[model samples]
Target: MKSLKNHISLIIALFTVLASVQIYVAVDRTIAAYETRLKDDYSVIVVSNKAFVPSEFKSMSSMIERSEPISTAQVLDRLKGEMSQKNLDLLRLTLPKFYRIYLNRYPSPKEINNLQRLLQRNPAIERVEGFAQTHDTIYKLMLLFKNVVQVFSIAIAAVTSLLILKEMRLWQFQHAERMSIMALFGAPVWLRSAVLFRLAIVDAIIATIILCLAFYVIDYYGFLITQLKAVGISVQLFNFVNDSLRSLGIALGISVALTFMIVIFPNEED
Candidate 1:
């Protein structure tokens, strides 16, 4: 039972580290998806003295994906009942050309400023509305979320790594007598440390398998998808092939490093 508990403890530690990293990955992807949606829906309105060409704006700023002219027909229709046909036609002809320009991706505050300045520099453009305030608020919030997740994941991984080392040390002590006896009998260090490496690899694989299976179940059930939909966004929470491989790699790496550390630096008494 004690041996089982030890194994379980190591597995749990490994699982916690893997879980923290996976959480960070999931949050980062979700934020990226949200940003993509925002980019697709967001646009800048430009008022120009002359008709605007999308190619002209694209040439001015690589960020500009395309532009569409805003129709003034509804405004003219609204005035038809009150004004004569000639007056309406004259007003339509004199109206400044309005265009909605889309960008390929969301821009940072500095980029927004640059785009506004670029548009305003054009002799034909009368005004550029980039919605700076709204964009800044959303951008800052997303950045804060990403930073928090990163810090949290790092903290968890650090603490769990210490726990993993402590567990390894305990295992080393438990096996010290056998190791010492082997050394006295002319057994090499690698041969004596083989059991520790085996244990490490076994526990790492177990932890990775558990993590992958848990996420696969969560993904299959669409729990994360439902939660995101409630918030009006969609994210790809997990890719079994990629994420599983990544988790396995991390687990094995940590296990191998800590095990090697313990084997290389045994207690001074040894």
Candidate 2:
């Protein structure tokens, strides 16, 4: 680790390997969870849980008038029955208050026109409208995140490699200018690419390990936080060490890759 550029390169390599893994896991988990929630919402729609404004009826002294709050269950049951008779489609249901989404046509567009008719005729019916959701927004955001992590990991690996290369080159030149000697020996240019590939594979392996640990830590912290919240406790300083180490590892790997490239490939014409 103390060795000049080589050690520096090694550190960076380790980081790239770890950071890639971490990103992979995070993205995977986030997307998976998001989809799961969406599915849950679609299958189960709850009626509005909004309590009636009690104060508005404050002047009504009659006990019966005061007690008759709007029935959330009644509204949902009526809506559901209407939809059934009309053969309408519902996309999802949400919340204690306002969490029901109706689809004009579901399962696909072919059935939508017919569904719409059913909804329009119902007495409890509100005007039905078709909706187009923005898939591109979600796609763009996910892609942006992926690119950022990729760049971070690559940069760390490259910088590390560059530093290592610089040391080796300097030593070679000082000892007896090995760069010139290699030219004389006609050492195939393939060597550079080969070395880079080796470094990449090594970095990938290290990154995978780091990623596994990252998920583990995230799981631990996430679980603890969830538990604390359930018990009605609040503690902030939640996670520092694990996150820092992960970042450090990524930065170091990128540096190594940069150093490796610079050292392996010389700009000077021999």
Candidate 3:
């Protein structure tokens, strides 16, 4: 029962670390997905005194993914009822050309300003609207969310590492007599510590398996999917193969490192 308790404690500690890592990964992916959606929906409007080819603006800024001329049909339709046909025809002839510009990705505030300035350098261009104020607010909010998640994950991992170390020390104490006897017989450190390595590696594998299964169940039930959809974003919560391998690596690394630390710094009794 004592051995079982030690194993369980170590497993739980490793599980906590792995869980925190996976949570951080999911949040990062979700934020990236949301940012992509924002980029797809955002655009800049440019007004010009004369018609211009969309390709011509691409040379000004490589950020320009593409551009399309904005039709004046809706404005013209609204004015048709208020103006005479001759007046409407005259209005169409005098209207400025407008183009909607799309970017390869969401731009930072400085990039937006630079792009605007480049566009305005053309004497024919009258107005450039990139909605800098609104974009800055959304960008800052996203950055804050990402930073918060990162800090929280690091805190959890740090705390769990200490817990894992404490548990490993307990394991070392339990086997101290055997390790001491082996040391007196001139057994190498690795040979004396084989049992600790075996126990830690076993618990690490068990913790990794448990973590992967829990995430699998969560993904299967659509809980993560439903929550993301509620926020108007879609993210894949688990990639079983890749995530499993990563979690296993993290679990083993933490367990082995802590166990080695205990072995290298033997207690006075040992």
Candidate 4:
């Protein structure tokens, strides 16, 4: 019963580490999807004295994905009631051309400033509006979110790693007498450590399986998807096949590495 309890504790520790890693992956991907959606909805407005084709804006900066000219008809409609035909025609001639420029992706504040400068450098452009205040707020919020997740993941990984090491150390102490007897019989180091390695490998596998199933059920049920959709962001919660394999590799690798370290470092009495 004690052995079973130890095994369960070790498995839970490994699962915690793996789950933290997978959550980081999911959050990273979701943020990327959110950025894509933001890029589609966000745009800059440029007022130019001369009309420009969409292709012309592309050359201004690689960040500029596309450009759309705002029709003059809407401006003319607003002035129609306030002016005669001759005055309206003159007003139209005086008004600068307006365009909405889209970016390929959401950019950092520095990139936004750079793009604004690049647009303003054009002699034909009278004004460029990049919505700096709103963009900065959103950008800062996204960065804060990502950093918080990263710090949280690192903290969890660090604590869980120590727990894992402690668990393996206990396992080593439990088997110390048998290991010592094997050493006295001139058994090879690998032969002496075989049991420890087997135990680590099996527990790692079990932990990986549990973690994979938990993610699969979460993904299959659309629990995360529903929440993301509520906020206008759509992203897959996890990739079942690839993430499962990755989690397995990480769990087994950490387990075997820790076990090997314990095997190599003998106790002071030994």
Candidate 5:
């Protein structure tokens, strides 16, 4: 029952919802890819520097740090001192901060027995959990938060898109007669084709841009974006889409061409 012009907000809102869904998927995928690459590089770097760092550095560091919270300055100082006992590999590889210097030798039961005898006496050494113990639970929790936001964003976007689409269709029905009459008239093939192609293409381009910008605002501007850390996510997607703009151009061309063909060709008594 609504006029199309009267429902401009609904159309725009639909675009916003679609864009938000796209932005969440794109950004999460990008971040995951980035993290994977970084993890690989970090692992390689850590591995290469292992010889210079103490074999039991993680174990030993845990022992010492049990007495106090790890001060970055103190940790780095300790690392520097350990790096002084250089071998060939240690000399070549650079040690990075927070780069896990694995205790290459897993503690045998006999070694553990000895370590317990020597170290467990101190109240500061209350517990000696392996690095895996600390990293796993915390890492999973971080990952869970990251995924929850993305999922929540998608759900909200989907619901908004459906609502807006419903509102937009109410507006669109008002134009149905005009569209049917255009088909009824003997509109020239070239004119109809060009008009339809232009209309669809222009609308698609406008939609894409609006979608992209809405996504950015949803991510970056806190007021509009209720999702957590969504700005960072949106910005990342913008960068990705911007980088692959050629794809958009190609898509536009294909869409316009297809629309032109559909409009120009005779079908169903038009």
Candidate 6:
């Protein structure tokens, strides 16, 4: 019974680390999707004395998805009754050409600045407005959110890893006398430490199974899905096949690596 309890405890610890990692992955994907949606609604306004073709900005073509000219008729409509037809004609002739530039994706602040500089370098462009203030605020908020998740995931993984390490040490101590006896015989180090390797592998598999089921339940019926829906960010909470394989790989890799380290470097008491 005590041995079973230890196994369960180790599995739970491993689950904590794996779940944290998977949660971070989901949050990152969701944020990236949200940023794409934001990009569709965001655009830069450019004013030029001469009309610009979409190809004029070809130097930065990778950053720019397309350019849309803002019609001068809209401005004329606003000042319709305020001016005579002759004055309107003169105003239209003097009014600068306006364009709205759309990007392929939301760019970082540095990228925005570089794009603005590139646009300004064009001889025809008089001014370019990238809405830097609003863009910076939103970008900073996204960075803060992602950083918080990263830090939280790291902390959880670190603490749980220590717990798993402690549990492994306890298991090693429990079988230390047997290992010593085997060592005194002709048994190799690998044979003497076979039990620890087996325990680590078994616990890693059990933890991965629990993690897969927990995420599956969360994906279908949890508040996380509802919350993301409310915010209009649609993303899969977990990818069953891909995520399961990744979690299993990470769990097995960490467990086996740690077990090997402990087995190879025994304490003075052992």
TM-score of each: 0.96, 0.38, 0.94, 0.95, 0.41, 0.92
Q: Scored by CA lDDT, what does every candidate get?
A: 0.90, 0.45, 0.90, 0.89, 0.46, 0.88
TM-score for candidate 4, please give it.
Answer: 0.95
lDDT of 5: 0.46
**Residue range with the least summed lDDT across 10 consecutive positions in model 1:** 131-140
lDDT tens digits by residue: candidate 3, 1-270: 989999999999899999989988987888788878778888999999999887898877899999999999999999988999999999999999999999999888888889999999999999999986875787689788888988988999999999988888887888888988998999999999999999999999999999999999998898879988997888888889999999999999999988888888876765
Tens-place lDDT digits, model 1, residues 130-225: 876875687689889999999999999999999999999988988988988999999998999888899999999999999998888888899888
Clashing pairs in 1: none
Error of 4 at 212 (Å): 1.2
The sequence of per-residue lDDT tens digits that candidate 2 reaches over residues 137-253 is 553465677677667756754664555556545433343354455657876644533444454445445554555565557556676447544644333321345644655555445
Q: Looking at candidate 5, what is the lDDT of residue 215?
A: 58
Q: What is the lDDT of candidate 4?
A: 0.89
TM-score of 6: 0.92
Which tens-of-lDDT digit does each residue in 96-209 have in candidate 5? Answer: 233332232333345434544554443433344333334345445646756886787778766755554344344334444555566579755565345445544555466566
Residue-by-residue lDDT tens digits, candidate 4, 37-81: 888889999999998999899988999999998888977998789
lDDT of 6 by residue, 80-171 (tens): 89999899999999999999999999888788889888888888889999886775686678778888999999999889877887888889
Candidate 6: list runs displaced more than 4 Å: none
Candidate 6 residue-wise lDDT at 98: 94
Residue pairs in steric clash, candidate 5?
219-231
What is model 4's C-alpha RMSD?
A: 1.5
Q: Which runs of model 2 end up more than 4 angstroms from their true locations?
A: 1-5, 8-10, 13-21, 43-179, 191-204, 213-265
Model 3 clash pairs are none
Error of 4 at 174 (Å): 1.4
Q: Better model by lDDT, 1 or 4?
A: 1
